[model samples]
Target: MEPTSDFDPARLARSLLRRSRQGALATLMPGTGDPYCSLVNLASHPDGSPILLISRLALHTKNILADGRVSLMLDERAEGDPLEGARVMLAGRAEEVTEAERELVRRRYLGAQPSAEVFVDFKDFSFFVIRPSGAHLVAGFGRIVDLKPGQFLTDLGGATPLLEAEAGAVAHMNEDHREAMNLYATRLLGADGADWICTGCDPDGMDMQAGRNALRLDFPERVTDGTGLRKMLVRLAGEARAKG
Candidate 1:
């Protein structure tokens, strides 16, 4: 069947943004406009814009202050030629998040990296949001797409309740629902074996890890709460059982 209207390059680009925990950030230097690169941890706003916690004293923060235009590259690690794996380059403008959105952004950012709380309270620390203008995703050889942000990104406003509960859900599934997660990976995701453990879940998908291998599985439909999440898992389990 032909790809649906909703299925486009942006969807895959957004998938990269959803799965990546860390990415390379490049900013223009103050004096010469030279590109300065740094590693940054990533989180997302409800609109799928990138959110970063950076100290004002950091050079990259200075770059954002001087010039907002920036680019971020996120890629998956794979065996064999690294170029064979999927990766995305996102270009945008970065600016400090406003007061009204500060707390929620901070909460989401810190949820993924609780250790960041130690420095998050520091005087120089602040949150910045990167609203992408354009993106390019290379899904291995023979697949490439140029994406506009509007088409690819997910507006997760409906999933606020789910985002808030994600950390607890991760812990619970890894601890109590290992079998279900394993089935989700093997049966639904076509991943190898039952050793995968659930790491996190968002409205669109769930992430799992088997040692260094991270896998993301999209729901048959979007889910945005514990109830929906449970329903999806149960349905997936039933499907897996039926295949037995």
Candidate 2:
């Protein structure tokens, strides 16, 4: 495999925060004085904080309001090979979102899970934002990466160069360089020519139409325009040639 970039804790955390599906939420049971754990679907805010859309009447939701202390574990369930994946657990305080924040939370949550539209109408269902006090990241069996509380939960403000570069890379690759895609697929990804097709592009990344799934690549280098993108392609092509 090509040399992977130095493992970026923030980037890795952001990636996991963006992609994972289910999370285990541990909440306090009101009068019982015990902790209640429930499997809930969750999403991350743009800055990588965890949030949950839950029913106010649900056991966990009620438990949270009664006592805001809670912990959320967002991780990929081990399947097949255990050594290749990672997981993150976050401990935090949960609170019902204020009216001003509800709309933004709803948009992000609904965008990821359109199916929730069916049950979102329930009067009991509401949005809860979790502000993590600490986090733990595990990359594989026996490989521990611990982080301080609130490490990945900060607001960094408006878009930065990384985001713009990633977007420009995607747009240029998808719109102007279709032929180069198949070459990269075979030369870089080591795929058969038939397995590669350019599907779509945006400012963030390029989507490859591979079989049943789409593969997205977020370019790490700056690519602001067609000229800059061409230079990137040339560099990639030179790398392929060097490997051959």
Local accuracy of candidate 1 as per-residue lDDT tens digits, 183-235: 87788778788577765677777766675456667778999888888888888
Q: Stretches of candidate 2 above 4 Å error? A: 1-7, 81-84, 158-244
Q: Residue 147 lDDT in model 2?
A: 73
**Whole-structure CA lDDT of model 2:** 0.63
Look at candidate 2 and give me any clashing residue pairs. Answer: 56-124, 133-149, 134-149, 167-203, 167-204
Total clashing pairs in model 2: 5
Clashes of 1: 1
Prediction-by-prediction clash tally: 1, 5
CA lDDT scores, all candidates in order: 0.79, 0.63
Model 2 agreement with the true structure over 134-229: per-residue lDDT tens digits: 777877544566676445543434334433354445446557766677767667757566545443222233335444322334445635445554
lDDT of 2 at 171: 49
